[model samples]
Target: MGREQEELWDAETAREYDTPGTGMFAPEVLGPTVERLAALADGGAALEFAIGTGRVAVPLARRGVPVTGIDLSRPMIDRLRAKADGATIPVVVGDMATATAPGTFRLVYLVFNTIANLLTQDAQVACFRNAARHLTPGGRFVIELWVPELRKLPPGRQAVVCRVETGYIGLDTYDTLHQHVVSHHFTFGAGRDARLFRTPHRYIWPAELDLMARLAGFALESRHADWNGTEFTAESPSHVSVYRLPHDG
Candidate 1:
């Protein structure tokens, strides 16, 4: 994250970031995520990239796997600290691509398409290398990202509406030439005007992600449609990918 990103995810954004008991916060949605990450942690410490507001980190910590995080936004980390002690759930405030945290870990994971937030090929690649540098031998790096919807975009169309729920809307505009997409979120409530938040991302194919992992001294361990290990098919909208470093290297 940088100046622009920090501004986009500022205090107001952090305040509204959590949607408890519904949407992403629903037990059904978050439980599976925490369960999978806990299993991946394998009784060792875990490192989270861009640990926003401690949503998954908190529950994962409750599962008894020690957790550390690196993030660029102090405001988001502040929100997390409000929920859990900085000493108990340590966080280093810096860019996930280059920030260093103490000690090695059994797992390094980035969820909610945070890897796409790097917004460039080189930065995303560097993120992979960073995760590798922070992991012990044979440790795993996990990422959850949406598969690009390029196939649905007709000729000359640049944007698509991804979600349209009551009082909320999500849209994405693509720039295929640059491998970029901007996510636009609209939120509305009673007696209030709708608010919009936009984030830019660099869309990546699974093959390219694999290549980046390989470049960073990792091999593809597994990929699935979601946390429960659903088989990933061509039509799947998103994927949870696991990559591993060589034990001997």
Candidate 2:
């Protein structure tokens, strides 16, 4: 993990993580993600990279797919342990790019743009290789990532406001030359001063990701615009991609 990433998701962030109720924990949002992952598990075990707060893993475990997780934040994993038995859905507290958990799995997945958190191309490629190391031959590795919307930036503009709401604002500034972005989030409440959080990410294109998978000994199996299996087109905002290792390997 990058130094910026290590300090960004601190204990305070972990405590306030699910409070917004608009992220991975939201039913309307998490349902389809879990459903897609469960289906891919094929009654075998699944491993989640960056499984924070058990948001998807808990429900996926309830669906009867054995699930384990690896995350960098102990506070985040502590929160997850509050929601699940330690033995039922074990978690390793370390960088997902290199962390190892017991046993192999039929499916290894990273979702909700977690791969971007690595903040470097080399780290991201190592993450793909790590995912491959944990999968059984012919097993699948899935990733859900946002397609970079660089077009939204006007000429000479490096920043874009992606969201504005009653009490919150979200903005991103891009380093186009390096394919890096830093997200700034501000939230306000009555009688309280606004709070700000920033996280860095290295955005990746679909073609580049496929190349990383190839370097890691996996082949592109499928790509979709969403979890429901919509076709990926030029205008899609995000994608769900699946890769597979050769069965003969």
Weakest ten-residue segment in model 1 by summed lDDT: 1-10
- For 117-184, candidate 1 gives per-residue lDDT tens digits of 99889999999999999999999999999999999899999999999998889999999999999999
On TM-score, the leading prediction is: 1
lDDT of 2 by residue, 1-249 (tens): 955565777788899887535755667788898899999998899999999988889999999999999999888888888989889999988899999999999999999899999888999999999999999999999999999989899999999997898989999999999999999999998867998889888999999999999999999999999998899999999999999999973
- What TM-score number comes out for model 1? 0.97
The list of candidate 1 runs beyond 4 A from truth reads 189-193
Per-model TM-score versus the true fold:
0.97, 0.95
